[model samples]
Target: MTVRTTDTPVRVMIVDDHEVVRRGIVTVIDASPALTVVGEASTVDEARRRLPAVRPDVLVVDLQLPDGTGIDVMTRARELSPEQRMLVLTSFDDDAALRESRAVGAAGMLLKSARSRDIVAAIEKIAEGQTVWPSRPAEDEEELSATDQRIVELIGDGCTNREIADELGIAEKTVKNRITAILHSLGLQRRTQVAAREAARRRAGWK
Candidate 1:
C-alpha cells in the first residue's frame, strides 16, 4: 500500500492471518496523513521476527492467529518496549480477551468490521497515549456467568448479537438473555457503561 501523508506518521505494524485484510489495513494506514504501515505479519512468528526491526509506535493485531494468539505477540511487544501501543483487531470480541488485553497493557481494541476511518482514528489516538474501545461496554465480571462474560467481551469488542452468537457457537437468543441478566445484575443502563467501568479499572490497575 502507498502512504500518503505529510504528518509525522504514526509507524504501525499490522498482524493478521488474512493477507487481504492486512493489505486493506495497510491501504488505510498508507492513506492516513497521520499513520504509516511499517510492517505486516501473518502470524506470531513473523510478528516476533519483524517487530524488533520495525519497532513501530503502534501495533494493529488480530486476536486469533494461525500459530498462536495475539496475546503472545502482546507479551513479546511488552518485553521489547513496555511503552509500545497495541490495538487489537479481531472477529471475536470476547470479553475475556478485552480484559486480558487491558490487564496486559493494550491501549485499545477494535473489531475487524470497524470503519477504515475509525481504525485510523484509533491508531492515532493510541499513538497519542489515549485509549479507544468499542461503543458497547462489557458487563461486570462478578455479575456475569461464564457464558455471559463471553457475551460481554464480544459486546465490548463491538460485535452484534449475531456475531457474538456465531463466535461463541450459541443461539442469538441466548446472547440476548445473558445480556438482560447482566444488565439487571450490574444495574447498568447500557453496555457502554461496562466499557467505561473497565477502562477506569484498568487505569487504576485494579485487576
Candidate 2:
C-alpha cells in the first residue's frame, strides 16, 4: 500500500544507470504525497559527488551499473553517513546482489518490477527504519558442496560456463552438471538467483 502523508516528506536520491528507469522512479517519487526526488546519478562517481550535496534521507540504488556495482555506492554512503537509510532498486533478482546490498547495510531491497504504490511504501518503510524484502526466504548457500560452491562463486564473478570449466580444469559438461546440481540444491531457478542468495546470506552474517 502507498504511504501518503504530506507532513513528513522523505527526501530521496536516485542512483541507476538507465535514464528511463531513473526518470520513471523520479515520476513515482514526485507523485507520492510524502516523498521527493532530491537528486539522481547514473554512476557511482556521480552518485558520490551528489550524495553529500543532496544529503537525502533515503538513497534508492540499482545493482548493475556501467562503471561499477551498486555496492560501491553503498560502501561510500556508509562511510559518509552510516545512519543514512539505503533502499536498492534493481531489475536483478540475483541472490548475491541482494546479499551484498544488505551486507553493505542497505535498509531494504525492492524489485524494479514492483508496483508504484509498493515502491512508495518501501521508501516510507525505509525512512521509518523498517527492513523490506520478498516474503519468501532466499535460498540457502551452505547447501552446496565445495565444488558446487566454487562453480557458483565463479559464476557470481561473471564467468561463463566454459571459463569456469577451464579454471577448474574440468570438462564443459561437468561444469554444466555441477551448476545444475548447485541450482537444484539451493532451490534456485537461475544462476543470478544463486549469486544473489549467497550475497544476502553473507549480508545477514550467516555461516
Candidate 3:
C-alpha cells in the first residue's frame, strides 16, 4: 500500500475534474521541494483505475467528480490501498461533505480557496498521519437548542438540577435527562466536568 516511508519526497496524485484547478494545484506542488506530483485523474473511475499504478503517498481529491463523489473514490482507493491517505480539496462550504470525507478515511479537508502554503502544509500533515479537518468557531459550539443551551449554561454556573428545572419552569426529571444527554454528547461523566471544560474554553478566549 504505502511506498518507502523514509526521507523520500511525498508522492501526490491529484483527482480533480477541473483541468485548470488540477494544473493550479500541480503548480503549487511544483514549488514545494518535499512533494512530487506523480499522477492526475479527472474522474472517479479514472482515479480508481490509476490509483494502484501511481501508488501515491497522498491523494489530493476534489469533492465533485464526473462519474461519482470523491468519497466514492476514496472508499475504493482505501480498499485497494488501505495505507493511502487522502486530502480533500473542496470549494463548497458543505459540512456534510467534510463528515463524509472523514467517514471514508480522508486524512484532511482543505478549502479550495486556501493559500498554497496551507494546502502544502495540509498535505504534509496528512502524509505524517495527522488529521487536518477545519476548526469550528467558538460560536458553533454554542449552537445547541435553546433549551439545551440554557440548561447547560445553568449547569456550568453550578446550578443544581432542581434549581435549573425550577428556574427554567421545567420538571426536575426533564432537567436530569437533558443533563445526561449533554454529558453523553460531550463524552463527559459529570456535570462538574462539563463546567470545567466550559471554564477552560472560556479561559482560552473561545468567545
Best by TM-score: 2
Candidate 3: deviation at residue 11, Å?
0.2
Q: Ten-residue segment with the worst summed lDDT in candidate 2?
A: 135-144
Model 3 Cα displacement at 192 (Å)? Answer: 33
The residue-by-residue lDDT of candidate 2 on 35-141, one tens digit each, is 98999999989999998899888899997777777877877888898788899988877655555566577878889999999999999998877889765454555
Q: Residue 72, candidate 3: how far off, in angstroms?
A: 0.9
Task: Show the lowest summed lDDT stretch of 10 residues, model 3.
Answer: 137-146
**TM-score per candidate:** 0.66, 0.67, 0.65
Higher-lDDT candidate of 1 and 2: 2
What's the lDDT for residue 16 in model 3? 98
lDDT of 3: 0.81
Model 1 earns a TM-score of 0.66
Model 3 agreement with the true structure over 1-207: per-residue lDDT tens digits: 333468888999999999999999999997899999999999989998899899888999998887767877887889988888999999986555664576577888889999999999999888888889888775553354567767777877888999998999966755765666566546677888888987787688775
Please report, in order, the local distance difference test score of every candidate based on alpha carbons: 0.79, 0.80, 0.81
Look at candidate 2 and tell me the lDDT of residue 199: 75
Off by over 4 Å in 2: 1-6, 138-148, 151-207
Tens digit per residue, CA lDDT, model 1, 1-207: 122243578899999999988888899889987888889999999999999999998898997888877877887998998788899998877665665566556888999888999998989888888898765444445444577666666776778989988999866754654565566556676878866765665578864
